[model samples]
Target: MSTNALPPVVDTDTWQKELAALRIREKAATRELDAIAAQRRRLPMVQMPDYVLEGEHGPVRLAEIFGDHPQLIVYHHMWNDGAEWQCGGCTGFTSQFTRLEGLASFDARFVIVTHGPIGEALAYKRKVGNTMTWYSTANSSFGSDVGAPRDGGFAVNVFLRDGDTVYRTWHTDGRGTEQLSYLFGLIDILPYGRQEVWQDSPAGWPQGPTYSRWLDSDAIAAAYGEPN
Candidate 1:
């Protein structure tokens, strides 16, 4: 390891003083995030069409996806037709949310909506060992309507259901979805951070091409010796 790459070593008193200073900034940032979340809560929503999508069972309506819950969170997974594996970033991100029972208490449900065929999407989900409920928009404009068109990109969309009506409350893609990923949050707190070239880091810090370290479903499954 290069000495230049490491953070400078300081005495206990100096370290404590610096850490205390950083804590103030951290607390301020936390407060700022809380304020932004308050703004997000107040944002208006747009009504959505009654698009039908393919689920594990059969054809299911968009409103039905809420499944007795008033709020729905969908991870718009990117898909490439006929590909054995799916998007690494999407797969990795979606995989982290294996358990979402806690959301039930909040009256919110989380699921994955992809442009891939239902069978292929489910197969990929299994290949990656993701337990999240997945639905396919291959035969509908739901994917395109929600900003995850076929061959396009991934997104995070939030919807609210009132009786039989559904409305889109929020949508975010690219780096905007970072806040939902604990993996990114954890990596960001590390000394090296993501080690991605685009990040602002001190001189001589290790950095590589963006997303070069991301692993697709197949790669992740193989690494863990999970059946694919």
Candidate 2:
């Protein structure tokens, strides 16, 4: 079991050079992200009329969730309204919800909205042990109107609802998945490698490309074996 038998790293200094190059790329990426966020901040605001959505406790209105705040940022995670596994990327993002309290202090409410029934969404949250607020679009047009219908997949939609008038501020549908991952500092670990991607994984390793929908219970179990 000698660990030194592996081939010697040719030109060890190359790693330092690679590290420098990566740093430069990282800085450029950060600048680009900042520009995008500036654009996001400039999006138009809207007043959302009070509307009810199903929650774990019972029925609650959008206003109740926001409390006195006028801004609500809903993460339309692609749960497929009861799909076997929650999206993998979403699971990663939701796992970091505890750090979002700063946004809350800024009069912002971050909630995960899905077409999944309230009960179903709660069950998934329980399975993942996520503390973030989970809401169901079961009794509301919020999901569809925000471009996150059951089949619509994952998206991040910012809304400003004064009373009953809901104005769509900004919405991201595609690689917006990148924000949640990057926000949670999970993107930085990519270069370190994902355990699931190990080519020589032990017997029962989750062998597949990681997707956002694997946040669900069944998929998590199937891909990565038993949950911790």
Q: Could you say which candidate leads in TM-score?
A: 1
Q: Supply candidate 1's per-residue lDDT for 194.
A: 86
TM-score of 2: 0.69
Candidate 1 local lDDT, 131-208, one digit each (tens): 899999989999898888787899999999999999999999999999998998899889899899999999989999
Candidate 1 local distance difference test against the native:
0.90
**How does residue 221 of candidate 2 score in lDDT?**
41
What is the lDDT, from 0 to 100, of the residue 195 in candidate 2?
A: 37
Q: Which ranges in model 1 have alpha carbons more than 4 Å from their true place?
A: 1-4, 223-228
lDDT of 1 at 146: 84
| Global lDDT scores for all candidate models | 0.90, 0.69
Error of 1 at 220 (Å): 1.5
Give the range where candidate 2 is weakest over 10 consecutive residues by summed lDDT. Answer: 187-196
Q: Model 1 — TM-score against the truth?
A: 0.95
Model 1 Cα displacement at 21 (Å)? 1.5
Task: Note the clash tally of each candidate.
Answer: 0, 19
